[model samples]
Target chain A: MFRPCGLFDETYAKNIAIVRTRQHWILIIIGLFIFLTFPLYLSGRILHFINLLGITLIAVQGLNILTGFTGQISLGQSAFVCVGAYTSALLTVHLNFSFFLALPCAAIITAVIGTIFGAPAMRIKGFYLAMATLAAQFLIPWMVTNVRTDLTGGSQAMHVPAPSIGGFVFNDQQSIFYIIIPITCLSIFLIRNLTRSRVGLAFLAIRDNDLAAETMGINLTKYKLLAFFICSFYAGVAGSLWAHWMRAISPDQFNLMESVWYLGMIIVGGMGSVIGVVYGVLFIKVFDISIILIGPRLTSFLPPQLAQDTAAGLAPFTFGMIILVFLIFEPRGLAHRWEIIKGYFRLWPFKY
Target chain B: MLLFVQFLINGILVGGIYALIALSIVLIYKSTRVFNFAIGEMMAIGAFILYTFLATVKFSLWIALPMTVISTLIIGFFIERLALRPLIGQPILIAIMATIALSLIFKGIVFFAWGSPIICYPERILPGEATMVGKLFLSNELICTFLITISVFISMSLFFRFIKTGLFMRATAEGHDLAQASGINVERIFAVSWAIAAMIAAFGGIMLGIRFGIGIGTLPLVAIKAFPAVLFGGLESVLGAVIGGLIVGILESFVGGYIDPKFSEITPYIILLLILLFRPEGLFGLKRIERI
Candidate 1:
C-alpha cells in the first residue's frame, strides 16, 4: 500500500538528497544473465523441483481462493487433492485413458466432491468449519485406504503409468517439467481471469457479507459452492499432476499436515494473489530444504543423542516460528513487500 | 449381544472424557472469542508436564497433577502473551495460525525434551475394575470419568454463578469494549481466560492419557477427536459439548464396532458432513448467526 502511495519514495527524496549511487550497465547485464541461467541450472539436476513447486502452487492458490478471497476457511484441502489424484490416477491406470482425458476427469470428480464437502460451509464458519475440513483431511485418506481397499491400495502406493503427451512419455524429471510449467502458467492465467470476472466479484461480495450479498440477489449458496468446486478442481489437477510426476498415488501423499503447509504458503506468499502463492511455496519449501541441508552439519556441534534426536523435529519448529513471526509482524505477507518494491521503482520520477 | 453391550459401554466411557475435552475448548472460545488450534498440543504439553514431573522426577499422582495444571497454565499464559495478544485486533486468521504455530512449537519442544517416546501413564489415581452387573456389565473408568466431569462442570457453574472474578470474566467476554467502559480490567480477564482454558485442557489431557495409556500420538488424535464433540455441541455452549461428545462417541463406536471395522474415522466425519449440510447451527448453536 505504501509503495503505490509513494510514501517511502517521497520520504527518501525529502530526507536523503545529498548523495547518489548508481548501477552500471554491466551490473544490469550480469543480473539478467544470472536470471536467464537459473532455468538452465535448474534444468540439469532438479528440474523436478519445478514440478513439485507447480503442484504446491496450485494447492496454495486454491486455498487462497477459499480463505483469502471468499473468506471460507478450509482445512481439508488434502482431502480434495486426494479425491482428484485418486480419480485421475484411476482413470489412467485402470480405465486405460490418456493423460489429458484423465486430467479433466480428475478435476470434475474433485470438484463434485468439493461441493459436497463445501456443504459444511453452509453451517460452519471460521474455526468450526476449519475443524470440519480437518476431519475431511484425515477421513478421506482413511477411507481411501480402508473402506475402498479394492480400488485404492490401502497403505501400499497405487502405481500410475508415466503420462505421455503425443506418444512421447514424460517418464523422467526433465520431461515432467514441461507439463508442470505450462500448466502452472495456464492456471495462473485462468485464476487471474476468474478473479476479474463477475464470478470473482460475487465471491468477494459473499466473502464480505453473505447476508448482504444474498439480499442483493447474489445467490450465496451458488457462489459458495462454485468457489468450492473451482478450488477443489485446481487441487485435483495439482494432485493428478503430482500422481503423474511421482508415478504413484498413496493415501500418505495427502495428509492434514500438508493442508496446514498449504495454508501457510498462502499466508506467507500473500493471500488472494498468484504471485503470493508462488512466493509462499518457494519460500517455505526452500526453508524446508535448507533445514535438511544444514541439519547434519549444525547438529554435529551438539551431543550425539541431541543431534540424532533433533533430525526429525527441527523443521516443524522452524516452520512454526516463521508462522508466528509472520503473523505478528507481517500478516499481509511477502507479496505486499513485493508491491512496495515495485511501487518504488514505477513511480520514481513523478510527484503523485 | 455381549459384544454390542461391551462396545456401548466403551463408547459411553470414552464419550464422557471426550465431552470433558470439548468443554475446555468451549470455555476458551466462550471467553476469548478465539479458537485455539493449539488445544491438542496444549493438552499434549499438559500430559507431558505430568509425565515429566512424575516419570522424569518420580513424583506421586497427587503432586504431579497440580504441578501439571500449573505448568500448563504457565504455558498457556506464555502463548497468549507472546503469540495471541499481539494478534488481538488483527484478522481472525492470524490468531488461528498463531495457535497452529504454537502447536508446532510445543510439539517440537516436547519431542525434543522427552524424545517422542510413548509413556503410558500409570492408572494410579483412576480406579480399575470397579464394576457391578447382573445381566449387563459396568466399568470403573466410565463411572469415574462421569463423576469428575460432572464435578468439574458443577464447580465451574458455581464459579460463574457466584464468584466475583468469574462474573467479571463473563462480563469481559460478552463484550470487551463494553466491559472496559464499565470499569472492568479486560486485559486481566483475557489472561485469566487463557489460564482457565489451559487448566481445563490439562485436566482433559491427564484423563485422556489415563484412558488411552499415553503416547505422543495421543495429543493430535485427541485434539482432532475434540472437534466432533465441539461441532455436535454448539461451539459456544457447555451443555452442548457434553451432549455432542456423547452423541459423537456413541456414533463413532457404533460405526467402528458394528458398521464397518476397517474405516472407523469415516463415520463421525460423515455425520459431521450431514449435520453441516442440513442443520449447520448444530443442536445447540444459534441459528441467527448463520450468515448464508
Candidate 2:
C-alpha cells in the first residue's frame, strides 16, 4: 500500500490495482521475463530446482490460505500431496486419461479427501485438530501402501509417465519449466486476487477470533472447509507436477517431514501474505540446496569417523537452527523485512 | 483364553511405558502450554546417551544411569532457556513448530553421534526370565517396567498434591499472570516442568531400549503411538494418560493379534481420530468454555 512520492490514484480501479504504478508494472515484467527465460541460460540442474520451487510455491500458497489466512493448522499436507500424485498417476496409467484431464481430477479428488479429513475441524480445534490431521498423515500413506498393492505398486516406486500435450512431451526439466512456471504464476495471480476479496476478509476475521466471527455470521464450517478444499487442491496440483517431473512416485516422497518443511516455509516466508509464500519457499529451498551442495565438501574437513554422519546430519541441523532463529528473532518472517525495505524506499526523504 | 490373557498382560505392561511418555508430554503442556512434538527426539537422544555411556564409554549401570538422567535434565533445562523461553507469548502453532524444530535438531544430533544403527544397552538391565502366572507368562522386564511406571505415576501425583514446587507448577499451569501475581516464579516453574518431562522421557526411553534396541528409526514411532494415549486421557489429565495408554496398548495388541500385525502401527492414530470426532475434551479433560 506504500506509494512513492508524487504518485496519486484518482480512480478507484487505479487505487485498488495490485500493480499500481508504471514502475511496479516494469519490475513485474522484468521479473517475469527472467523467470520464463531461465531455461535458456541456466543449467538443466538449476531448471529442475526451479520446477520444484514453483510446484512447492503453489502448495505453500494453498497452505497459506488454510493455516496462514484461515488459522487452521494442517500437518497432513504431504499426505494430500501424496494423494494427488497417486490419483494423477493412477488416472493416467490405468484409465489412459490425458495429463490435462488427470491433473484436474487429481486436484478435485485431493480436495474431497482433504475435506473429509478436515471434517473433524468442525468438532475439534487447536492441538486436537492438528492431531486429527496428523491421523490423515499416517492413514493415507498406510492406505496407499497396504490397501491395493497391485494397483498402487505397494511400497515399491511407481513409474509416472511424463506429461504430454497432443504429442508434445514434457520429458525433461527444461520442458517442464514451461508447464510449471506458468501455472505457478497463474496460481499466484488467483490467490492474490482471492486474498483481496470478501472471502479473504472472512478468513482473516475467523483467524483473529472464530467465536467473534461466528457471532458476525461468518459460517465457520463453510469457510473452514473451503480453506481446506482450496489448500488440498493446491497440494494436488503440486503433486501432479511433481509426479510428472520426477517420472516416478513413491510414498516416501511425501512424508510427514515434507509437510513440516512446507509449514516451515510458510512460517519463514511470512504467513498470510502471498509474496511471503514465495519468499519462504525460495529461502528454505535455496538453503537446503546449498546445504546439499556444501555438505560433502564440508564433511571432508572433519575427522573420517564423523564425516559421513556429519554429511548426513548438517542439512537438518542447519535447517532446524535457522527455523529456530527465525522464530525467535524474525517471527514475522522475511515478508515483513521485504515490506520494511519497500516502505523505506517509498518514503524516501520523509520518515514515517 | 489363556493366550488372550497373555496378550492382555503384555498390553498392560507396554501401556505403562506409553503412560510414562504421555505423562512427560502432559507435564510440559500443563505448565508451558507448548505441545512438545520433539518428545520422540528427546526419547531417542536419551536412549542414545544411555547407550553411549553403557556401551561406548563402558560405564557401570549405576554410574551411567544417573549420568544419563542428569545430562537429559540439563539438556531439557537449556532447551527451555535457549529455544523455548523466547516463544512464551507466541501463538500455539508457533510454539508447536518450535518443538518440531527442536525435534529436528535433536534428530540431527542423534544421527551425527550414533549413525542410525540400532544399539542396545551393553548388558541386560532387567532380568530376561518370564514368570508363569497360571499359564499366562509375564516377562520380568515388563513387570519391572510396569512397577516403575506405577511408582512414577504415584510419586508424580503426590508431588503435584503436596510439594511446594509442585503446587507452584500447578498454580502456573492455571494462569501465568495469576501465579505471577501470587509471587510464584513462573519462569522457574516452566524450566522445572521441562526438566522433569525430559527426565521422564529418558526413563521411558531406557525402558523401551531395554525391550527393543535403541534405534533412531522406531523411537519416534513409539512417541507417535503415545500421542493417542495423551489424547485419550485428555491433554491435561495425569490419570487420563495412564488409562488412555492402557486402552491404546490393549487395543493395539488385540488388533495386532487378531487382525494383522501391520494394523497395530496405525491403531493409535485411528483411535486419535475417533476420540477427536466424538470426545474432543477427552474422557477426563476439563471442558473448556470459549468466551468472547
Candidate 3:
C-alpha cells in the first residue's frame, strides 16, 4: 500500500480495506475490464492460451494455499487434477450430466480423495509427505488405467463433450472463454477472501510453525486436512476445465512432470501471495507455450530427427534453468521483483 | 514351488540393481541432507557414457567400465560444485528443488543426445544365453547384474567400515558442525559422497542397460523405484537401503507372480506408504525425538 505525503486513514474500513484508495479501485476496475475483454482483440491461439492460464491460475492457487500458506508440500497435485478431470469426464459421458454440475462434483470428489490421502500428513511431514503425495501421483494414474476401463476409457483418450446449456454449445475458444473466465474470477475472489478470513489465518499459522500453531489451539489434523481438501478441490476444478477445453482426457496428461511444473510455478511466483501466483503462471506458461511454438523453428537447421529431439528438449531445459536461476538468485520469486519495481516507482528520484 | 523360486531369483537379480541406486540416494542424503531427485538422471548419464564407449567406440567391456566410472565421477563433482554447493546452507526444501531442477536439466541433455529410442548394446559384450541353476533358467545378463551389484554393495560396505574417508562421511552425517569442529573437511566429504554416489549410479545404470537395453526412461523409473527402498530402509542406513531394496524386489516379484502383474508396479509404493504411516522415520532409520 502506498500513502502520499501526510495521507491518513480516518476510519477502520479505510485502514483495513484491500482496495485502499479511489485510484486503487479505479485501477482494479480497469484491470478487470481489460481481462474480461481480452478475447475481443486477441487471436484464437492467444485466447486458447488465456483459457489455459485461467485454469492453471486456479490450480496453482490451491498449491499456494497448501504449500505457500499451510507449509505442506504436495508432489501429487497432478493426480488430484487427474481425478477431477476423469471424474468430470466420466460423469458427463456416462451420466449425461451437464458440465456446470459435473465440474464442482469432480472437485468435491477430488477433495474427498485428497482428504483420505492427507490423513497421513499428521504423521509425516517434509520429504516423507512428498513421497506420500508421490504415491498419489503414481497410484491414481495406475488406477485410472487398470480399474473399470469402461468408465475411464482405459488408457484411451476419453472425449469430453463441450459444455452446453439449452442447446448452446461452448465448442469454440470464445465460448469456452466465457465459461472459463467467470469461474476463474469467482475462484480468485473466493480464495482472496479465504486468505483474509480466520481459516486463512489458521493456514498461515500452521505454515509458520505447526508445533507452535498446535500449541496455540490450531487443530493440526483438521486444518491440514482442510488445506488438502481445498487445494485438491482447486486442482479438480482446473482439471475439469482443462478436460472440457481440450475435449479429451488421458492418464498421461497428469503425470509427475506436470506436478513438478506446478511446483516450479509457485516457486517462481511468490509462494504465499495471490498476485505472485498470477505472475508465476503467466511467466512460466508463456515461456512453455513459446517453446512449443518457436523451438522447432529455431532448431530447423539440424537433421529432422535431431531437430525434433532438440525442440522437445528445449522446454524442459529452459524450465530447469529458469528454476535454478530464480531459486539461487531470487528465492522470493517474481512477486518480490514486482514489489521492488513498484517501490522504485513509488519513490522515484527520492532516496528514502 | 520351483516356479516361485524362479521368480524369487529373478527379483533378487533386479533388486540388486535397485539396491545400488538406493545406495547412491542414501549416501547423498546421509552426508548432505539433500535428497538427490536427479540420481536417476545421473544413472542415465553414466549408462549413456558407457554406451558410447562400448557401442560407438567399439571398446571392450573391460575398457569401457572404468572409463564410464571416471567420467561419472567428474560429472558428479561438477554437479556438486556448480549446482548443489551453493545450496549447502539453504533450506532443505530449496536444496531438494535444486536436485529436481538438476534432474530436468540432465534429462533434457540426455534426451537431446540420445532421443527416445532404446539403444542396444552389442551382443558380444555380455553372454546372450541363460544358464540353468538346478531347474531354473537365469539369463546371463541377470547373473552378471546380480553379481556386479552385490560386489559393488559389498565393497561400499567395506569402504564405509574401514576407510578413513568413509569414517569422515559417517561423522559428517552424524553432525556437520561437530564434524567440522573435529577437523573433518565436511564440504570435501559432501563432494566425495556425491562423486562416489554418481559412480555407483553409473555402474548400476550400465548393468541395467545391459539387461534391459539402454533407454532414456529406464534409469529414471528405476530411480523412482529406489524411493520406496530408501523409505523402507531409513534414508540414512546403508545396510537398510540394501535390505529394503531386496525386500521391495522380492515383494514386487511375488506380487507380479501370484497376484496380478500390474499390481507389481505399485506394490513397492504401497509398502512405502504403509511404512510411512506406521513408522515415518523408516524401518531402519534412527528416530530423532523432536523437542519443541
Off by over 4 Å in 1: A1-45, A302-305, A344-352, B1-4, B122-142, B289-292
Report residue B22 deviation for candidate 1 (angstroms).
Answer: 0.4
C-alpha lDDT of candidate 3 relative to the true structure = 0.88
Candidate 1 lDDT over A1-352, as tens digits, reads 2323433434756444322224545675687576444555566546666668788888778877888788888888988888888888889978899988999889888989888878767656666677668768877888788765777787799999888877699898766776777788688778877887799888888777778888999987778888998899899998889888888788988988889888888888877776778889999988988888897787888788777657657877889998888888888789988887787678777644
lDDT of 2 by residue, A1-352 (tens): 4456676789999977988778889998999898788888899988888898999998899989999999899999999999999999999999999888999999999999999999998977777878888999999999999998899998999998998998899998888899988999999999999999989999999888999999999999999999999999999999888888888899988889999999999889998989988999999999999988888898898787678888778877788888899999998889998888989877678887
Predicted structure with the largest lDDT when compared to the true one: 2
| Order of quality (TM-score) | 2, 3, 1
* Ten residues in sequence with the least summed lDDT for candidate 3 chain B: B120-129
Name the lDDT value of residue B176 in candidate 1. 78
Candidates, DockQ: 0.57, 0.79, 0.67
Instruction: Report the TM-score of chain B alone for all candidates.
Output: 0.91, 0.97, 0.96
Which candidate number maximizes TM-score? Answer: 2
Task: Give the C-alpha miss distance for residue A223 in model 3, angstroms.
Answer: 1.4
Please tell me which model should have the higher DockQ, number 2 or number 3.
2
Lowest summed lDDT window (length 10), candidate 2 chain A? A1-10
Candidates 1 and 3, the one with greater TM-score:
3
